[model samples]
Target: MRKRIIIFDDDKDTRTICSLILEGLNFEVITQENCIDILRILDLHTPHVILIDNHLPGMKGAAGIRLVKESPRHKHIPVVFFTGTNNAQALADEAGADFVLPKPVDLARLEEVIELAINS
Candidate 1:
């Protein structure tokens, strides 16, 4: 089965590239430029995996995760904290993410991570 994924990031280029990479890997990808209204997304659809940016304009990444965790319908969704630096690991921990990966991630690694995330 094809997995559905969601990417929430403020960077346009990052979103575009990641979307392409995931799509190439045979995954269905949805991207959000602004994650301030993630609750609305929960109302629409539930993705198998959610990839969020560490740095955004309005709220912290952890805050986004907390919101997801609070919702029973969406709380079980796996999340990956996408960052541009090694610091992402610490931030991802703070955000309650399942994993942390730097932006412009290695496609092979991403593919492996996706498979693991979906199965786990």
Candidate 2:
């Protein structure tokens, strides 16, 4: 089966670009604008990796990552905190994210992070 990646970011362009890139790399990519129903989404997709941006419309990405980490059923899945925010590494650490991806996202780095998350 193809590896699945779930992305939560409010920016439409980022989501589209990421989807295209990952899809090209043969991943099944799912993107959401917010993490309001993150658990529901997780239950449905069971992704290999989750990429999230800190700023979101509701249920911010950091909080969403925390929620997933706190869940016994889903905590094993790797989470990559993708953000443009300052102190992103600190925020990702606080939220228990497995990795961090900073924006103006370098597509190559994005792919590298995803690969690391999947392989780790």
- For all candidates, the clash counts are 0, 0
TM-score of each: 0.88, 0.98
Clashing pairs in 2: none
Regions of model 2 farther than 4 Å from truth: none
What does the lDDT read for residue 88 in candidate 1?
Answer: 78
Stretches off by above 4 angstroms in model 1 are: none
Clash number for candidate 1: 0
RMSD of candidate 1 to true structure, Å: 1.6
Candidate No. with top TM-score:
2
Write one digit per residue (lDDT tens) for candidate 1, span 11-89: 8888888899899989899988767888788577679998888677787666887788778888788888777867877
Residue 81 CA displacement from its true place in model 1, Å: 0.6
